[model samples]
Target: MGMRVKQLSQLRNRIVVITGATSGIGAVTAAKLAEAGAVPIITGRSASKLAAMRGRVSGRCGFYELDVTDNADVQRVVDRIATDFGRIDVLVNNAGFGLFERFEDAPLEHFAKMMDTNYMGTVRCAKAVLPYMKSQGNGHIVNIASMAGKLSTAKASGYAATKHAVLGLTNALRAELAPDGIAVSAVNPGPIDTPFLETADPGGGYAASVKGYLLKPAQVADTIVRVIAKRTPEVDLPLSAGIGIRLYGLAPRFADKTLGKLLNRK
Candidate 1:
């Protein structure tokens, strides 16, 4: 673990607050950060699951029950964390879910819910942590966006919109926070083998079609850990997916005919 140690050296004793951390990528990240000597503070809607995560994570791991959609709750939790930790070194906004439904078939409430939870939830948490980070003179904010934000496909218009908002917020915050010694990063990962797929594609057809390309939760968790250490601006995973996003941007017509058609499997 020499290479791993070198990568995580900067994180020793840092306090990392991770939202939606009871399972999946967030869960793995908490454990990995703990191994790197960072104090991992996990949050989720389920108090029971949060306790379980604290037990599972190595070393000192704290947890809080958080529902990011609630603005007051977000402020309360973040304040409590800051008071306990003295300073918040990093915040990973990973609390989000997706649903795949055609624009015409999807209910308006679904889109609103996604926007409220995925986008506004991030806004609330980021705002809550600002004063603490600003006072400390340094901090990192990592938002777990998605490839769909860049390249929207069929049956995911609502979900894609939410991710797109997250990406936009991340980019703007990076610029705004630079002078304050704060770094913002966006992790745009493709499909990962996690409960996320279960919610996004309940039928499992999309997962079945994309099985070979699906990334493991740890793969994304590792990237999140690295980005915190390096403070990278943006990271798009799975070289192939990155290539497709680039190709789509460069030649939309050609990509739509080839890559877009292939990816519209959902």
Candidate 2:
């Protein structure tokens, strides 16, 4: 019992920076980390929402208006956080959007937007923080990717592509920063019950397809907390989905045929 308390105490007061913290997974994660006694620095595009989020979370909280897609803004905000906090203990790259549409039918601009916001945004944040983390010689970077990164669906071409890039970046950075004592991990979650669907599938087609199987944002947040506390390498939410994705990797064509049928069901 004493050891458990000690373990929990170790997590207290660590500075954690979270992107896309205005809503969805980012908001939930920030609140949970704060509850665990961590000092959370939350960033998003909306000032009002940022204020409200800061109010909702317990402990010392910092809120910044940031659009992750802006490289200069990301760098400046991250630098300021490092300066204020003395060191950034953890960085959660959770700022991203999804666009669902058939590749042939999707607009080129949509693909560009996803790439910039999801992939490049993560890159920018990581680049900005790497120096501080490397100098400190210890830090954790948690990239919030998705199951679509490992396995793509019909209308999720653009979204999947961006997530795939995130996975790639996470994996590569994990190795690149290892010698510097920095850990990079990826959290690949399946569909979660969030406002993402409103933008990802405006028509509600994909949401309808995944009905009853959606994960809660709190569940993902719990996993993320564990990732930061334990320095877990990679986490795939809903273990079943992770297993299925692995199995699919073993037999691509057959698995795709079988899974496609299941996902296409009405």
Candidate 3:
């Protein structure tokens, strides 16, 4: 307990930036980091929603209006944060959406939007912060990927594609930034009980299938905080899910048949 407290104390006053912090995992993470005494810098597209989230935080927090898909805007906000805080200790790229539909039925525009916001948005933020982190010689970049990144399902083709890209980017960045003393990590959480489900699968088909296995936003936030403090390379929430995904990777044919039966996939 003593060591744990000491470890958390290390986050005190650290400038931790979280994107998409107005709701869901990002919002919960901001509050959790604030409890650990870190100065949470939050960004979201909604001004009123961001203000409400800031008001809910216990400690001093900064909020910015940002749309991660906008490269210039991402750079501007990151620059302002770096200037205001002197250095950004950590960045959590959590601003992304999901579209769950069969590949044939999915719209092309949705594919473009997911790639732009989910994959390239992460790239923009990481690129914007790298110079500052390189100058400081120490920083952490945490990408909020998904279990889908590791394994794709029937209706999540587009979402999975973006997450897979995220995983690839994160792994390569980890190798590239290691020499600079900057750590890169990926948090691949299974389905969580949040507004994301509503947005991703408005028809409720996928949500209903995974309702029993859904994790809480706070649970994911706790994992994010631990990942940052420990500099863990990759983590999948709910060990059982991670184990299943690993097994599937080892035996794709057998696992796909089994998972298809279990998930009622066509």
**Candidate 1, which segments miss by more than 4 Å at Cα?**
1-4
- Ranked by TM-score, the better of candidates 1 and 2 is 1
Each prediction's Cα lDDT score?
A: 0.93, 0.89, 0.91
Q: Which residue pairs show backbone clashes in model 3?
A: none
**Best to worst by TM-score, what's the order?**
1, 3, 2
lDDT winner between candidates 1 and 3: 1
lDDT of 2 by residue, 87-139 (tens): 89899999999977878998999999999999999999999998898889999
Error of 2 at 105 (Å): 1.0
- Can you write out model 1's per-residue Cα lDDT over 1-266, one digit (the tens) per residue? 78767869989999999999999999999999999899999999998898788677988868899999998999999999998888899999999999999899999999999999999999999999999999999999999999998989999999999999999999999999999999999999999999999999999999999899999999999999999988889999987888878877988988778776578989
For candidate 3, the lDDT comes to 0.91
lDDT of 3 by residue, 112-162 (tens): 999999999999999999999999999999999998898888788898999
Query: Among all windows of ten consecutive residues in candidate 2, which has the lowest summed lDDT?
Result: 257-266
- Cα RMSD for predicted model 2: 1.6
